[model samples]
Target: MSQDYDKILKENIEALILPLADKLLGLSLGRLEEIPDDIQTTLERRPDFLKRVISSNSHESYILHLEFQVKDKAAMLNRMLLYYAMLKEKYGESIKQYVVFMGRRKPRMSTQLKEGMIDYRFSLVDIHQLDYRKLLDDATQPEQAVLAILSNFKKSEVDTILPEILRKLQALTNNERKLRRYVRQLEILSNLRDLQKETIKHTEAMPITYNIEDDIRYQQGIKYRKRQRRKYRGNY
Candidate 1:
């Protein structure tokens, strides 16, 4: 994937994670109260999504750090360990971390660091292993509906599920700009499952009117193009 598209996907995923933190974390941590804007680390490294969540009973609170990885990278375990140390330095042992893998290939990353004295570990979740129908059933939030495209959907169900998700997205918003943004996100996410063609077909068929300039991703693309142009001129 292009670097620009990668950035946009990460940003969109981060945006969705914030609003749907409860639903996502509920998979492992049960009910939680997200502490907004409490994720800054001492080393200036920000996790993709971080929040101090309080249990529903209000008795326990812990920092939940989540990172989204498009593909397995070397030193990922070390990086996660660094995050664990930093978060632990600030929040003590009351921190739980998870890395959500969104790559197409099966994940081959290690989730633990067991050296002579270090035995740190974190949870690794493969999106493909998750049942996307659960997210689709969450009708209250359109973000979940959009994310369902990235989850585990059988090849046979693509035609049925993709169109239904697009329709739900369309019904969730009437504003052209927001609708376009959601459509773009849905399209990008669909790439993870190789359903981009189907996503585009359904999105283009929607009747929403939107200007390309209104899209932040589009504006970013324009800026990148201009920068490339300037660099090309400078080279000559």
Candidate 2:
């Protein structure tokens, strides 16, 4: 991934990718805790291109791989099948395979020939289909707010419908513990990335602006003041 694309990926990992992965792949906080160590390591140590993998509790499991494809390639299934084989070899047999499609548009699924045997078993999730409007109606209050904040990248266009989004977010934060965790994670990641980008820009234009002493003072004073407010608020 190019630097710009990588930045976007970093931004989306917590906001969009992780949430969607959890939703479609049946990953919850409790479920994730049950994954075996070897499988967990494989997921954690995926190559630069691959995003994640998930497995179920039953003996039968499917490996979910995330990729960003600009254009559909002919050998996509073949490549995924090969990855499945590699994973099986690393672990033992008795593992299924799936490749998640995360892109601007939906991808056309194609059949693959595996040594003259046919195999076409994978899943695709076009992020574009996660429309804010659809989620607003179908999703619970928490999910609705999550979808809205997750779509912060599309804020300008989405701002028109944000009254409901804000309502959902506020409601979710007050009620759902799990969703509150997700929202906090998303906020932390987004803020860190934004700060990183701003720091990089300032360093490139005026290097001396990268003043750690001043930053530490500001953090201690301003951030500490905000943290102290937690005592006054019941929900904080």
Candidate 1 per-residue lDDT over residues 205-231, each given as its tens digit = 778775767644577699899999999
Most TM-score-accurate candidate: 1
Give candidate 1 regions above 4 Å deviation.
Answer: 1-44, 213-235
How far out, in Å, is residue 113 in model 1?
1.4
Which residue pairs in candidate 2 have backbone atoms (N, alpha carbon, C) closer than 3 angstroms, thus clashing?
Answer: none
| lDDT of all predictions | 0.72, 0.45
Cα lDDT tens digits, model 2, 1-236, are 13333444544444444455545444432222122335335443443233223344443444335554434566777666655666567656444344444433457866355455655455545444455565555545354354443332353443344445545555555544443343333333223223333322322342122334434234557777787787568575
Relative to the true structure, candidate 2 reaches a TM of 0.43
Score candidate 2 by lDDT: 0.45
Error of 1 at 178 (Å): 1.9
Model 1's TM-score against the true structure: 0.80
TM per candidate comes to 0.80, 0.43
